[model samples]
Structures are given as structure tokens and as C-alpha cells.
Target: VEPKITLTDKELQAEISELCKYAALLDDSQLEVQVKDGVAVLNGRVASSYQKSYADLLAYRAGAKEVDSRGINVHWRHTNPLLRAQRYEKVTDEDIQAAIQRAFKHDPRLLSFEPQVKVEHGVVTLTGDVGHLTAQQAAEQDALHTIGVQRVKNNLRVRWPDEPASDEQIADYTRAAMTRDPYVERHNLNIECENAHVSLYGVVDTQFEKYHAEWIASRQKGVVHVNDYLAVRTKWKPKSDAAIEADLKDKLAYAFVDPDNQVTAKVENGVAILQGTVDTWYMWQTALDQAIAAGAREPHCLIEVRYGLPSGPHYYGPHDYVPR
Candidate 1:
């Protein structure tokens, strides 16, 4: 049996305040923290959604039973020069195609498959068959990160070299893969296979684990498509909307390595709404993954990809590096 820990309300409040003061993302000078009956209420404004959410997590870590952050408002700042430059510079169709090819060449997973790329104005259409779903996603990401790409139409299909395995075989492979994956192995997931498609039905703590399960299943040798019906299991001791939102914001900020990416999250009635801009499709997907991890039941992702921009803090030539 686990031992129960207790703290007085005054002690809890002091600890929460100290935690907030030392938090790297939060501006302690602008915010105020109050505690009552182990619940912490945060007031004031933050520069980004990331900071607001991070502050809430600090409160929880400091032994607050609950956190309220509705008083905090998000005031975002526009700092990216590339976003400003887009209004003046016009990227041609040829440049978009070249950029897409460069992105494909840079990604080790997509290096083997030469998907045909076509560009019309700023719209890119990719049509080819890859070994698996991850490669197909990589191809679409290639188009999404290309400069001047206004939209991506990924018609890439999965084409495996080996003979199609039976549903039982696919299920076996999926189970083995899930067992091997560190993120997914801890959960008691239910796996179902039909034809080449696999379905996952289970409850996990975070959105990352839910998507990670799907990613693992999608990579199985015979998997053509994955149907994820996995749910995020709420903890026995539930957190307030403010706490969940704050947790989500920190998760998203950490999940996407690029500091320039501006993503924000809001939670209401267990639903999380995300809005902002990222440099690549991977980061966009990662933002959604973080939302799910934060225990949002229905995460509405409104994030957009601004391709052909630097993905990280440092320069890595002209093309964005493919996340391994």
C-alpha cells in the first residue's frame, strides 16, 4: 500500500509560490498565486500559452490539489522575421518543388522512396506508394515544409514488398511492437486486426501514449491503416481545467523543439482547443499529441504549418531537418 502525504494549506501555498518563482517559462513578477484547502488559484497575464500552462504545472508539483488559471490571459508577441517576409516575397512553383525534393532527400525514412512531386502555384500534390504509413506521412511533411507551399495534397499510398499477412499475423506483429515500445508497453491496450487494418482500444494517461500506440501499430509489417479508438483515462483524483490546460501547454511547448513555433491551448469541459503556427507537419502533429497527453477528451487542433522556415533556434542550412 502507498503511504498518504499531507501538507498544511499555508505550506502548500508557499511551496507553490516558490515553484512559480523559479519556473523558467513563467514571469513571476507579473503573476499572483493563492492557495486554499490545497487548491491554488493563479492570476495575471503571460506572454504565451506555453508560459501560462507551465505555471499551472508548477502549482500542481508544489502539492496543490487543484489549480485555477482562467484569470490568466494569453498575450502573444509576433517575433518571427520569416512570417513577416512572406507578405513581400513571392515563392515560385519551381522553388516549391525543389524545396519539397530537398526535404525528401534530407529525411532518412523517405530517402528510399522517390515520390513524384507536382506543384501548381503554391499547391503541392504528392502521388506515390511508400513502404508504410510513416513514410507516407513523411512525404506529406516534405510538401508541408517546402517554401511557397500553400497547400499539400498527399495521395501517397502504402505499398509493401512482402506478401500481405493475415489478420492474425498483423495482430501478432502489433502486439509484439507495442510490447517493445517503451511508451506503449505500460498500458493494457486492446488490439484488434481486420484485413490489414488494425484497431487500438485502450485507456492511457496522455495523448502522446495514445498516438504513440497508433504510430507503433502503423509501422507493423502488414498494417495498411490504423483505427485508433483509444481513450485518455482520467486520474482517480481529477485535476481542474486550469491544471489540465497548463499541463497541455507545457507538453506542447516541450514536444515541439522549435522555440519559434507559437502554439496555444484552451480547455473547457475536458475538451482542448489548440491554435497556432508551426514550421513542419511533425510539429503540428506533435502539438495534438501533447493535447491528448494532457487528458483532453476532444482536442480540436487549429494549428497551421508555415513551411520553408527555420525549424529550430540554430540554422541548419536552407531546409528544415526531418525529426528522427
Candidate 2:
């Protein structure tokens, strides 16, 4: 058994050395290939974002039945070199699902969204509207990353494709972004050019409004970056609301006619005092009107007139009022 295993290791190594040379020939693909038995793994990097997808194609064509591709992709800003790679001995169904789920998670645009993808016999079938054309393509490319995936059938639709758009088509992909999006209008969100960069300065009330405005600016082609400084806040509160309470003492001081009735009228940041009022219905009206007209923001006042009525305290609702 030991001798057989030794021969197997030697065979796997030789296969890898030969495949590595072939992988180097692909366009802009810097992949370092390794093989163990019939399985293969590709390491290193590619320049285009599409390198990962293209590299996987080469692996299968080289007669690899199973693949391990964890280190096949690395971002442009990545500094780490590929340490090592080897073909996985066993490929499970969970491996494919894990790879698919990974594609959705790591890709920034796909994380909070869903796409109808059907994986069967290592072939991925994609259907449904994925917000935009680019996301649909990204999902397909991601499916191709899995070890056993044979092919991808892109049945996905972009809800809108005819309208002229402004996105750079590579950076944020705003044209493809606005199709299934609920906010953007076909012709309303105008993107105009200014010195190679686009600036959006406008007012937006709803979240959809802000999203559409940003999308329109983002869609403008030749745009290196979008500079959006739009206003979204709105005034929904009153300018001033004053709650004032006053005792009968203040009202009595204001109305000079009522010396017996101590009355106080509360106004907006103002005070009305009435004194010497022996109450009648006619006198009450006369006293209230005087306080309102003389001092109040809106000619409105809350009047507390003490008629000096002789009565015992009764609890109508709240706390008892102690007579001073």
C-alpha cells in the first residue's frame, strides 16, 4: 500500500508540472496549475476581473474531473503571493453549494439580494430578474468558479434595457442598477457632463428619490467618480409651540375694570393681568377680549378668571387645587 501511494504522488506531481505550463499560455492568465490524480487546482492571479472564470475553464479542459480553486482569485490590492495549491482528493455536493453561496456573499453587490439559481449535475441554471444586466453576469461568473460546474445557462432578464444611461458600465454599473430598481425614471434622472466628472446637487425627499438621483449621476459614462451633495431633509415641525399656564392673579391685574375678579390670560411669551372684576357673563367677555387684543401673538389667549365663587373643592379629574 505504501509503495502504491508513493507512485501515485509521483504521478500527480508530474501531471501538475505539465498542466502548469499549459495554463501559462492563456491570455493574461498567470495561474500556477497543480494536479493530484485526475483532480486539478490552479493558483496565482489574473489581470482582468474575468480571469477567475477563464482560469476555471482551462482547468476542466486539461482533463481535471475535480478542482480545488480557493486560491485562484485575489483582488488587485492583494499583496500575498500564492503559497501553495493542490487538487482536492474528494469533491462533495456541499462543495458546490458552498462555492455558490460564497460568490453571493463576497461580491459586494449581491450580498443583500437574491437570484434564482438552479444547480444540477454541476451545471448552474440562472433565472429571474437580478436587478440589472451586470449582476446577472456576475452571478453567472461566480457559478463558474465552483469545482464541478460544467456550464452556466443564463436565463436572467434585465427589467429595462432600452433607455440611454449614464453609468461607466464598469465601476458602479448604474445603468444595469436602475432597471429593476423602483426609484429611477427612464428620462427624468438627467446626467450631464462637467469636466469629466459628474456632480449631483438637488433636493430629494424620499429614499427612492435619493437613490434615483444618485443612480442617474452614477450612470453617466466617462465618470471616474460621482460627487453627490444632495439635500434630503424637509421641514415637518412647527416653528413655535408654547404651552402656558397662569393663575387668576395674572388675569386680574390686566383688566382694570374687574377689581373683584382676579384673572390671568396667558399668551405667546406674553402675560395679561386683570383685577377688580365682579363677574357677569357680559363682563367676562369684555375682560377676555381686552387681554387677547392688547397682548397675544395670534389674538388667542387662555383665560383663568377668579370670580371668588364660594364653593368646596370637588375632584373633577386631576389633583386638587389649593386656594392661595
Task: Name the best candidate (by lDDT).
Answer: 1
* Model 2 stretches astray by more than 4 angstroms: 1-89, 160-324
TM-score of 1: 0.49
Top TM-score hit: 1
Output the lDDT of residue 320, model 2: 14
lDDT of 2 by residue, 1-324 (tens): 111232343454444433332232232344666667756666776555555665565454334566677776657643223321222224344555555665564455565467676777767787876555446656787676555566889787544434533333332343345444655433222122333344443234456677556655443444434555433434333222233233232443555443555454444444333333344323444444443334322222223323311111221221111111
* Worst window of 10 by summed lDDT in candidate 2: 315-324
Superposition TM-score, candidate 2 onto the true structure = 0.27
Question: Candidate 1: RMSD over Cα atoms?
Answer: 23.0
Total colliding residue pairs, candidate 1: 4
